[model samples]
Target chain A: MTAQAAQADQLASSHGHLVIIGGGEDKERDMAILKRFVELCGGPSAKIVVVTAASAVCARMWETYDRAFRDLGVTRHVHLHLMTRHDANDEDLIRDVLDADGIFMTGGDQKRLLAIIGGTALDAEMHAALKLRGACIGGTSAGASAMSGHMLAQGRAELHPEKGSVSLGAGLGFLHKVVIDQHFSERQRLSRLLSVVAQNPYLQGIGIDEDTALVVERGVGIEVVGEGAVTIVDGRAMSTNVAEIADHATPELIDVRLHLLPAGSRYGLPGADDRDARRIPPPLLEFLENITKRNPIS
Target chain B: MTAQAAQADQLASSHGHLVIIGGGEDKERDMAILKRFVELCGGPSAKIVVVTAASAVCARMWETYDRAFRDLGVTRHVHLHLMTRHDANDEDLIRDVLDADGIFMTGGDQKRLLAIIGGTALDAEMHAALKLRGACIGGTSAGASAMSGHMLAQGRAELHPEKGSVSLGAGLGFLHKVVIDQHFSERQRLSRLLSVVAQNPYLQGIGIDEDTALVVERGVGIEVVGEGAVTIVDGRAMSTNVAEIADHATPELIDVRLHLLPAGSRYGLPGADDRDARRIPPPLLEFLENITKRNPIS
Candidate 1:
């Protein structure tokens, strides 16, 4: 494995973390999703900071979560409503972040979340807290997408990657080097996400399926949660002629490798498992290999 | 001056090109913008290729341009109407690009434009045309933003060089090396742009004021157009604690400098043109000096 791969392995074992909760209609049925987060966070009683950036969620989404938070006995749950029209530099949001033991970003528009919180004291505070305190940060749906700097807003179709179909918007940047795409499986957004990563080789793309979450512990790597799989696209390892595309004036074939890890599996860079980094299970690896084979650059 | 600066100078002076009109208010206005583009190309009667990606003009934007196409005392006009639905990818769009003489991107959501044309055969065609034919591609608000691969979707109102307020989405990727922001001066968006460039120094950040456009000729250099100034934030000269930010924390000041240039001004990188490269013009030099002086350690 390359040094970056090795470094990724190190991240898997670190402690600073960000987790995602799948947000589909069956979220309530998947109580296991919430339970896993609580367990990883050392229980629901853990002091938590909840930031609601999604407008789609209202009292209903909260009701679904109230039980989870209560069952976990998280009494000091602080919800920071960050969707207000205030500038991203709002002192209130920054202070809330600084004081929080754990930070939770709600799902909605990655653009809105990044627009409101990115580049501000709040964004800085969260990064510092994650790195220094090993504080946990979590999100769902749009929230999951916000975990990474590269996000998929909307696209033409999953058939092929078009110009703006696979968009890279500003995410929370919590997963700074990676791009996060939500509702992966159900949405069949693989093509869109692939297009994004291909354009930006510097980014690693992660796609989270519904009812699934990837609990990423800084220095500790990633732990999968709930049902379905998490698709990881690492373009850094691929070879490309993107710079020469114009000269050729033809659609070039790109070699992209993907990893489809199912729930409970752990994936980190090389050496990630000196502690608990899970190896790519045979089944998942086979599935990913099949995908690349079927989609072999045409 | 650095060697890159000198190279930029030589490139700017050597390339004679056609202008692509991408943004404006309406087709009539877009057409007027196209007319301006024709003037830039050579004269009002110059043969122009209009690539219509504007939803407003896709089906109808061409009809409106009929008069100008005929009345410009000329008849050579290549108009391609490219539009994609939310989940549809039509191959014809790419074909449209391959046959274009000069390309014009219409205004709308830079996101939408990217969605339809992103990684398709069309994107390669446009890029090839530019590099080989020296086609002038100009976009207005959305069009201009799409010129750069790192296009600004939206930003927070934060006016500090912190992190997270400014979010970037994927654009056409035609301008891969730079990150661009539009409607800059009108929205008071300098700090956000600075924060963006600071986060990723490998990419240059440009903020184009409303009505103003920065025309960059690949082998030549860049020239400003329209009403306002183009803020160029070159971070390669920066020395920062990127290690801290990479570790999921915030960036500490090290050494950074920025340059803000008005229309008609230019910057030359090494091996380009060292002398008469706009002379660094006092105002532009002052802008660069201020960034370094403001924070010795960026």
Candidate 2:
């Protein structure tokens, strides 16, 4: 695909706001995201749909949602579960979610969530609602990590960035360019994030600390929210021994230069922005202009 | 690197059994791995270096080691904190780890471990120790994920075996030609693993379940240990999907024929046993051989 098309694709939006909260037991932080979630859902009175994919709070999830919706004054709240093959095509659940204004994925193991919904009818519907219908999508912890194209599962839990510490898994790819790592600082996972970036030089990695959230606006790019800093690892500028290393031998020594961007800063990737800081690059700017003028693919 | 040569390189020293475990907070499981680790260390009395890059349990990692070592009747135990920039290259730590007969990494956040030690002086030394000195290197969860060449960071968390849910990152590459995912069954991450192999059509993907270990016998291949099954996602015999689709708008979908190999089965990519039915074909064997022998710079 051409760089222009890539930018245009990134700019297309069927949703108002996408929020990814880092994992932790921060009710206050969660509430902030929930508030935005409600706003994106078309206000406190808007109907809401919540999906508890990888949550340990299984039976209690619906009750929790009931409380949240009641406290927020939402007109309606529905909880959907896709744990089995049959659940993949639950028409009622899909309809509720698609018709709702906001969809939220609860935290647990993202892998579990993906396994149950991936390639299923519900997954297709969910994508359609978010991509075509402009529905708000939000998640926390594993849910947050699942929103990006690249998701950090587990890394070799070491203090240093090693060749194999950062393990990758599948994510939702809602935000295509960035990979998200949760419980970042509280867990001290900088090395894993860096190692992850080093693995996929094509991706720009973001590590959101606990209590933090990354607010991604379709065309505008990412903004950070919450109590902690969001560490960003841009591998585009990295120089490495990856290409030069001999096969099977430990990779040769190389230093990676990293950029730590907290919430609120907007950055663009290669071809997406002008090299000069003064003006928007012609290529990306044109692409964005196209997105604004033409109808989205959905 | 002829298969023979690669064998020679791995066989050059003991390197013992390279055991990588997925994440879980099970003491019994940890104890079992510890037992294996001690055996790999050559004896309880043998000086064993325990590195807790994965676990924040560094402060008490030694106690765990001591308890295990003492229970095993092995005396000499060295616990080091290799979590910071300086600690990663602590001259004494490196020398101790290199000098020791066994090297173990605790579980916590593999990303942290990778960051500080990756491409550092200590990393090189440790690899040398493993390759030339026959040291046993063990890790769990994030540690297990880091063992492969293609590490799965975060990708799309969909259950579809499509090209998006999983993203590939640079892994330790100790086991080239393989991509790893941890906590497989419990997390229901099969689709992500399948999609990862689909993108990397040539590589073999191994999904290790919690409390499970993949004992890779260098040239001989892998043996699964622990309670759960090691899901092996092999795309070597896979069929392509380009023609099935109408346009490039659809990313490649993998009709991955998955094999869930339980603990105890041996896996050798293609050339391991001269095409035995029992082993998965090591697709990269030929390419790996050619690359090694010719040493192609380009």
True contacts kept of each: 0.00, 0.00
Query: Looking at model 2 chain B, which ten-residue stretch has the lowest summed lDDT?
Result: B289-298
DockQ of structure 1: 0.01
Please write out the lDDT profile of model 2 over residues A212-237, one tens digit for every residue.
77765454444556656565555554
Compare the candidates by TM-score and give the number of the best one.
Answer: 2
* Residue-by-residue lDDT tens digits, candidate 1, B168-273: 8887665566777777756656556666776787776777666566665444344555545565666665544435443322343223333444444454432444
TM-score of structure candidate 2:
0.44
* Ten-residue region with minimum lDDT total, candidate 1 chain A: A289-298
* Chain A TM-score of candidate 1 vs. true chain A: 0.76
lDDT of 2 by residue, B50-92 (tens): 7776567778866765676777777777776766878777787
Candidate with top DockQ is 2
| Candidate 2 error regions (>4 Å) | A1-15, A28-30, A243-257, A263-298, B1-298
- Which ten contiguous residues of candidate 2 chain A have the minimum total lDDT? A248-257
Docking tier of model 1: it is: incorrect
